[model samples]
Target: MSAAPSLPVRALAALGRPVIAAARATLELWGVLIGTLAGIIRSYGKGGRRPRGAVVAQMYAIGNRSLVFVAVTLGFIGMVMMYQACLQFSRAIGDLSQVGLQFLRLVVSDFGPTLTAMMLATRVGAGIAAEIGSMKVTEQLDALRMSGVLPIDYLLVPRFLASIVMTVALTILGAAIMYGAGGLTAWLSFGVNPRTFFDPAMVQPRHLALGLVKAVTYGAAIPIVSGFCGLRARGSSEGVGWATTAAVVGSSFAVIALDFALSVGALWLFGGDL
Candidate 1:
């Protein structure tokens, strides 16, 4: 066997300590999320009834409360997308219908799902983390455990289920808002008729399915990352701040990365049908 490392080697090893710790923490977080998922699934099958009120409250919190912001943001996105598409198409065909068709594909398949997810990650993910982290720092999590409540089952599951459902719902809602706003923008800004700005045929079922896939994955990622960071938090207010920040950052990165992967995969499989 080789001898032990020298002092220099040990000193150099410290350089990698942070990286290794981060990697380990990431892996541990994923493990916790996986366990949480399994717990939710197990609870759903033969498990006792979950708190329906909690789930409903979560849905309302995650879904209904987010509509105004989603609407305004997506509406602006739609207008911008329409303006750009019109500018490009006007130089070529000058056909509003064609412009509308292309816009629909680009927005519904990619931007709609991706941007909405990022927005949700920024807002909802941070909120989840802050709340959970505060609870953690306050010893509320331990109290729940002492009270015979499975925290994962009682807390994470409802959030997960609600997030998945709401993100999917919001994707569809945002798409509609975007399309409508784009159509109007096209008409007002580009002389394209409103009637010609929206073509139902442009939105294929494949696009719908792809959007849903993005929504679900992004949705799951946000709450999982956020809740995990929050639950693991220590210290005091600073810890909660760090957890919230981490949730937003991690969820944002996950959304973008997942969007790219899904886009590439779908393109490979469907040859742009997606």
Candidate 2:
């Protein structure tokens, strides 16, 4: 056997391991995304049929199940946010007038979709990973492959389609709840007029477009990342647990990174108008 490596060499190896792993994971994620897109395209092609009612089932699982959770969370967040904004304005500018307008714009362009996606990343991502990971460890995925089925097409495509639709719908619902709750808090706590606190004048069409784009992108990302993690699961239950944790972390990170990149691109494209 060769001599053991030195401390410096060992440290370098340790550092390089994670870097290599990260690069590999990134490439794998891109593959999963591309495969998912191809699956979607193929499903819509001639003589192609998706699993019966699969998309709707997934929609109910991803969207309907998440409604109350999203609403309550966003409502309280909005209330707290508005209270803080009013307090700051009272202390600094002594003007609560523009707070709602600015808050609405921010929510529409960023907070609404981003926050909703973050919440779903935890709930939906873990579920997807755990389910698929369980199947993976049981060799169910292998069984599917043996049966002449593409796992990405049968498993991921429905979730992908459902997530996109539900994410957008939930984002709209969450944004509305957030804004409405914020306005209520401002009125009750700060004596601000409801009319002034609920103004939508400052929210532009670009803000709407940006929020829609972000919602759709986030929706697409969560399922693909989670499914990829699931497909890679090994061992037994422990592997499923690991995949679940990774899916949550990875999906959340994707949302944040995508948010940053999209926001920067929007800012660049729209300039000061954004």
Best by TM-score: 2
TM per candidate: 0.92, 0.96
What's the C-alpha lDDT at position 19 in model 1? Answer: 85
Q: Show where candidate 2 strays beyond 4 Å.
A: 1-11
Please provide, for model 1 over 107-200, each residue's C-alpha lDDT reduced to its tens digit, 9 standing for 90 to 100.
Answer: 7888888888888998899999999999999999889999988778777888888999999899888888998999998888888876776776
Report the poorest 10 consecutive residues by lDDT, candidate 2.
43-52
Cα lDDT listed for each candidate: 0.86, 0.95
lDDT of 2 by residue, 1-274 (tens): 9999999999999999999999998899899999988998888877888655999999999999999999999999999999999999999999999999999999999999999999999999999999999999999999999999898998999999999999999999999999999999999999999999788999889999999999999999999999999999999999999999999999999999999999999999999899
The most accurate candidate by lDDT is: 2
Inter-residue clash pairs, candidate 1: none
C-alpha lDDT (0 to 100) for residue 2 of candidate 1: 96
Q: What C-alpha root-mean-square deviation, in Å, does candidate 1 show against the real structure?
A: 2.7
Candidate 1 wrongly placed segments (more than 4 Å): 1-12, 92-96
